[model samples]
Target chain A: MKKWSLITLVGADQAGIVAQVTQILAADDCELGETSMVRMGGSFSMMLRVRHDDMDLGALLKGICESLNLHLHVDEDVASNCEETDPDVNITVYGADRSGIVAEVTAILADAGLNIIDLETAVAGTADKPIYIMTIEGQALQGVDALTEAAKKISKGIELNIVPIQTLRA
Target chain B: MTVLDILQYPDERLKQSSKTVEIFDQTLKDFVTDLEETRLAGPGAVGIAAPQVGCARRLVIVDVSQLKKPVDNHGYLLLINPEITKWQGMEKGREGCLSVPDYTGNVIRAESIRIRFQNIEGEWIEFDSGGYEARAIQHELDHLDGMLFLDRLVSRRSDLFTRKTYKK
Candidate 1:
């Protein structure tokens, strides 16, 4: 049986954060899989899945945190057997930065029987007139029409481009 | 002219290399009409290939004139046994295919190209195409050799984007 663990780390944005963390993982002879890292605001965040040889995970976390000046959280019981389906579509929302954008959109998707697989958002421009861009990729549970109508109900001043995913591959 | 059914992805027929057209008969002409009708029927479709419609012939149709984006393009083109003779400059362009409708990806293609092809009348014609027109043509031509934008993704993790929905 494979022992899979999930780990999350966050730290103030700086150069070489990725190198330092990766070097530590390499030193431990651990296998890293399914990872995502991003810079949000003034901080950097990372989430990763790993398989280690029954090492002291608590001590490893402390060493990583102290050396990289970051915080670490780990869950040892993550199930690795679940299979994920590809998303049915990709929704991109662009408008003025404001609260509730993700909440409202995710609520609509959830209600329409859509499962969000991945999401990324960023705010650009200025503090006074920031541009909020959100991309949500997920699988549709029902049909395409239901999701389109739900997306259409979003507030004005926001531009939504809905593209139907080709379920076929070449 | 009737709109032909487009072959979706994972169809073995789409992966087969198309045969070059040697005879310009009425059957070929009729196929072109159906191809044009099918392309027009697709939402925002500017070009299409024969393999997309399950035909293994070297044929494609392109017209970028009506798009909202102002592009340096020739009005309408019907290419038969088309071949790119020369190409220059490289740039990344976002593209979605009618056959591969669900995803869009950034593909690196030549910014400008010189191509030779047979028109509807079976006359070999050559032209210098650039910008969006060039990109569209390259995408359709890739189908002749059984290639999709997914196969040309600059980076599978970063360049590929799932399309939301196409609204009229």
Candidate 2:
């Protein structure tokens, strides 16, 4: 029986991190699955799924992590049986930087039964006049109108725009 | 009227650039009829291109009259060898393709355009279009040059999204 494992790696950004890690996996005959690697705030982070049959992949990864001064975590991965829903709307919020922006916006979505499938936040502008921008791709379980009405509760100073995703088959 | 087969992506044929409609005759008119039928057969499709149906000709049909929400649109357009002479502004919008059935991507397109094309009768016509109609024309025009929305993705990582199934 093949086992699935989720591996996460985080370390200072440097070249060859992907090449070094993937090289080891290739040599071990580990089949790689869904993976996401990104550089965030001067740190490189990678999350990947691997399928293998009875290999000490964790020990090998640990050795590489120790040599490279990186952090690694591996855990058994179980595929979820839940039905997947596609996101139907895009939520954009931008305003003066505040601590509760994400919290407040997400709380409204949760109350409205909107499931956030993807989210990205960025801070821009000068240090003194920082601007917060957040974009969320969400599945509106309670319909777009319900989600829109619920979003009205969001406080002022924040500009919120909700656009229903229109898919054109041309 | 016949409904033509829409060639799916990776077909190689879809990547081939289409030729200009030089001899517009009964055969071209018949093909346009079939293409319109095929577009209507599709779910919520607003426009279709000649190459999509395996005919490598610079022809496209667009009709935004039936859209749920009212917007500025040219009722129904059947264009041959359409060309965008002028365009202004740019905005990122999500787009899906019948050829690439399983994915949607954010692509930046001109917000408005001045276009010229030959009607089915082989007479040249010029018009200005904005909003959804302009976007549809741009999308179909890309097919004439063998370009997909994937080719114009705003960001490879952040812009592409997958759909579980192409709703029949």
Deviating ranges (above 4 Å) for candidate 1: A82-84, B1-168
lDDT of 2 at A116: 93
Candidate 1 on B37-124: residue-level lDDT in tens?
9888887788999999999999988888886546788998999999999999886556777777656665788879999999877899
The docking category that best describes candidate 1 is: incorrect
**What does DockQ give for each predicted structure?**
0.11, 0.29
Local lDDT at A51 for model 1 = 80
Score candidate 1 by lDDT: 0.80
Per-residue error at B160 for model 2, in Å? 15
Per-prediction backbone clash count? 8, 0
The weakest ten consecutive residues by lDDT in model 1 chain B span B156-165
lDDT of 2 at B91: 61
Clashing pairs in 1: A90-B163, A162-B164, A162-B165, A163-B163, A163-B164, A163-B165, A165-B102, A166-B102
- The parts of candidate 2 lying over 4 Å away from their true place are A1-6, A26-34, A49-60, A74-86, A126-129, A143-145, B156-168
